[model samples]
Each structure stands twice: as structure tokens, then as C-alpha cells.
Target: MNENAESLSRRLIRNFNTAPTTHDVREPLYDSIGARLAPGTAAQKLGASIDTVAPGKMSCPYHFHYAQEEMFIILEGSGTLRVAGEMLPLRSGDVVFIPPGPEYPHQIVNTSDQPLKYLSVSTREQPEVCEYPDSGKFLAMASAGGERVFDVVQRRSNDLDYWDGEP
Candidate 1:
């Protein structure tokens, strides 16, 4: 075993005794969302992280991934899962799998009066591109060899027909 692998595995086991936590926030950039108990900088380097959401907050933008796949397993409270064009009501112990593709743009919104928690797992080196179908927003990781960069674009309507006031 290499030194890097051994060091990482040791850090993972020893670091969990006191995990980092983040306060939930109502941020517009994330599209009306919040997260608590999110892994810190070190944990992200390992692979995945856990997140908690409060009531009236969304887990992420209603989006789909092109490379990274995510699974959300509810730990508490009830929420609505907007996947594809359908909304699935979810509660404690409910699990949802979002495969990597354009077909399943998924987001979880807490509708109950309590906090909801879940674990988010993905490969550390996977490249991801996310698209919000409803808002026509796109975000992807840029390859700049520096900090993670994002590209945003809005979808334009192709139908250019003019219509009168009458239906």
C-alpha cells in the first residue's frame, strides 16, 4: 500500500469522531436551498459527504447529472422528490436513486416542519455536469487547473411564432 492511501484511510477513520457541520442558509445561487452537517474540505477530498436540510429548503436545484450519480436516503421529516416530471412524496427511510443522464432531473424539497438529513455519495474524481430543466440553467466544472469553476447558460425558446391576444 502506498503512503497516500494509508494516510487517507487513517484520516477517514480518525476524523469522524468530530465531524464538521455547516449552518443551513437560504441562498439564491443554489436556488433556494440550505445544508447542515456537510463534510468539510478534507472529507470532500476522500469522496462523499453527508448533508442535512431544514424545512422549506431544497437540497439542490432541480437538476440532473451527466457523470456523477447521487442517492438520497431520508433520515427524518417528509419531503417531495421532483424527479423527471413527477413529484414523489418522501418520508423517513425513503430512498431515491438518480442515475447519470438527462432523463432524471432530481431535487428534494422539505415540506414538513422538521429537518431532513441524508447522505450523498459519489466518486471523488468523477466529472459532473448539471442541468436544471425547469429554469433552463446549466452548470459544469471547468478544467482550469485552479479552483473549481462553473459555466452557466440559460435555455432559449426556439418557438419564434407571433401570437395575438386571442387563444
Candidate 2:
């Protein structure tokens, strides 16, 4: 088998029961799995992943993106969506759209006793920044406007002003 056989080859998954890579997130108590399905495919601009959150767990903190956008399709079980300070019920077959912006901060909370499964798709936008509302933090990755040389920076949400470091 070639080293890149699977990634470069086309295939079908009769069961979307899991992802190509699966891992346990103990701090949050959830299972995460995903495949860079399009990295070697024609759709290099898009990416997909499947996540299963244990009961009473969350996929991530309420956050919003500055460049990329995401869409999620609930595959099974039930959960709640925390969107811009609002809690919305989520269930199987529900589709969620999260566009880039500070107003679109969102998170998925497993509100049911069973595991919550969902398929998430997002754009591969570079030089992105993510804002975490609850933690008052900002995660930024600047690659000089998409250059391969990336600089990751994280700062508190209430940190200094834009001109704080200016001469």
C-alpha cells in the first residue's frame, strides 16, 4: 500500500459511525474523530469532521471565527446550541450555520443522556482568528495574509488597546 493511498484514493463509507482518526477528550469528556477528507481531493477549500460528545459534554466553548465559516448537521442524539448568548435545542437532522463574525459565537452542549453526534464542515480560510466569549480570550493565526509562515497569538479579550504596543 502506498503511503498516501487512503488519502489520495476515493472511497465510500457505508457507515458514518466514526472518523479516520478518533481520540478521547477527557477534560471535556468527549470523543472526537475526523478525517481531512478533502485535503487530497478536489475540494481542497472545504473540510469535514464527525464528533460524538458524551452526555453532559460540549464540543467547544462558545466562540466565533473572524474568517472561516462552519456548518454542522446533527446526525444523532440531542443537544443544545449556545449561540450569541441564547440556548437553542438541537436534535437529529438539525442543521446549523455559523458565519464569520463576532455575533455568531456558538457552542454545542449535549443536553441529553445519550451521546450527541454531528458532522461539521468548515471553510479552510487562513489567517483566522477565533474569539472565546466565556473565557474572554482571542486566538489568532496570522500567516501574512495566507502565507505558509504562520504566527499564532493568543490574548485576553480585555487586553490592551490596539495602540498599546505602538511607538
Candidate 3:
């Protein structure tokens, strides 16, 4: 391994709560927060984050990925998993797996009075495309240094001709 990789290695993260919370004020009712844990460690193949959602809030919109796969390990509290129009209860120690496909748009909603916490893990594939099944919107993304350099959201009808502007 390289010197930087060696120096960045991490064996333990004692407290997930110490990571602090983050959310968008515009999202109000749908707000959730997370701490990215693996990116700082220079993890190459996979990425991880510890997410927490307040009661009655959702973690995200119902969407499915085109290239990336994701899994979540519930650490505490209770919630509901909504996938492809199906609703399922979730609790501590639950493991949720989501593979690449248009048929599995998913989201999490905190149902109990307490905060729901989970560790989200996903494949680190770039140039990912995602679709929101319910909203008829799509997302195109390209990442560099763990930040999205190109992120676009559009409707299916916005697609342009492939030969447009071509000589």
C-alpha cells in the first residue's frame, strides 16, 4: 500500500453521534442527516455513511440506481422501508439490500418516536444514473474526490437527439 493509504487507515470509529448532523432546510419534513465514514479513510471499492432520521421524516426520495448498489445496516430505532410500492417495517439489526434496477425504487421513513440510525454502504462506481420512479425524473452524476462534479436532473422528455449538433 502507499504511504498515504497507510496513514489514512482506520480500525475503529467509537462514536457515530460525534459525527454531527447535516440537512437541507428546504427539505424540512423530509430532512435527514449522515456522516460519511469511509471516504475519509480512502476506501476505494465501497463507501459508507452513518445516517439518522427523525421521526416522521424520510431519508430520501424513492429512487433506483443504474450503476451503483447499496446496502444498509440498521443500528437503532425503527422505520419503514418503501420499495417498488411495498411498505415494510424496519428495526435495529435489520439489513437492507438494494441492487441496480429500475424496478426497485426505495426510501426509508422513520416511524417510531425515536431517531432511526443506520449505516449505509454502497459500491463506489462513477458516472451513475438514477431514476425517480414516482416523479418521472432522472439524475446523472459524475464524481471526483468524493464530490459530484456533474449532477443533472431532468425529465425523460428532455432527452435530445443523439445526432444533434454532430457534424
Candidate 4:
């Protein structure tokens, strides 16, 4: 294997050992969602896993990838899928796919009273830029300084573009 691949594998194992297996509360976007990322697994590029969310919680913010494609297969409970511009109901045994594009800002929200469980799979090497259209937030991965951030609105001074004068 290549050096980078070997290094990533080692890092993944280390992260799995050190990272918390489960979080008690939901993350940045969800109200009551919690996740348990499987250790030593790479879901984004190499495919990592095992996500659980509580009722009224969201799997993620409404966002779309630039290069990565993601798939979610429901294992339990029910939820609502906000994809493209529509909200569709989802339940156990349901499968949803989000392809790379700005047209689909996808997210899952649990409306049922029980916990929601699912397995998410994706390719490891994809460079992705995600945008939350409703919130006007954008995040770009694979950048040198880590995640790049942007706002979706025009600035007060129309004379300059968004990234033209920033540090």
C-alpha cells in the first residue's frame, strides 16, 4: 500500500480507539440526535458507520456534496427526508441516495417517538463541498487549512466578491 494509505489506516485505528464511541446528545444540527461512529472505519472515503438519532433530531443539515455520493439505509424507526426541494416520509427498510450536486440539499429528520438507526456508506477519496441552502452556509473539504467556510449571500459592498478581500 502507498504511504498515505498506510498512514490513514493507522490514523483511523487510532481515532477509533481514542474517539468516543457514542455521543449522549445530538450534534450541531439535530435537536436530540446522537451518533455512534464505528471505530477503525472510514465512512467518508473508506466508509465509516453506525449512526443513531433520537426523535425530532436531524441526521445532518440540508446540504449537498460536490464530489462525494452518500447513501443511507434505514434500520429502524421513521423519519422525514428533505431532498432537492421536497420533504418525503421515510421508514425502516427505506434507502435514500444523495448524489453530488447543489440541486440536492439533503437531510433526515426523525419525527417518530423512537430512536432512528441507519447505516451510511460513501466513497473515501471524494472531495466534497457541502452547502446548507436554508441556512446560507457552505463548507468545503480537502482544503489545505482544513474546512473552508462561506456565506451564500452578497456582501454589503457589492464592489468586491466574497473571497476577494478576506484573509
Number of clashing pairs per prediction, in order: 0, 0, 0, 8
RMSD of each candidate? 8.1, 4.4, 3.3, 6.2
Score every model by TM-score: 0.67, 0.76, 0.86, 0.66
Quick one: ranking by TM-score, best first?
3, 2, 1, 4
Question: Model 3's lDDT to the true fold?
Answer: 0.85
Candidates ranked by lDDT: 3, 2, 4, 1
Say which prediction, candidate 2 or candidate 4, comes out ahead on lDDT: 2
Candidates 1 and 4 compared: the better one by TM-score is 1
Assess the local accuracy of residue 40 in candidate 1 as a C-alpha lDDT between 0 and 100. 30
The segments of candidate 4 whose C-alpha lies over 4 angstroms from its true place after superposition are: 1-20, 24-44, 143-167
Instruction: Output the better candidate (1/2) by TM-score.
Output: 2
Encode model 3's per-residue lDDT on 9-101: one tens digit a residue: 453332466765576333666867888776456467788888889888887888999999999999999999998899999999999999988
Angstrom error at residue 146, model 2? 11
lDDT of each: 0.64, 0.76, 0.85, 0.67
Top-scoring candidate (TM-score): 3
Predicted candidate 1 versus true structure: per-residue lDDT over 69-97, tens digit per residue: 77777766787898888989998888778
Q: Give the TM-score of candidate 1.
A: 0.67
Candidate 4 pairs with clashing backbones: 26-33, 42-47, 42-48, 43-47, 43-48, 45-123, 45-124, 46-124
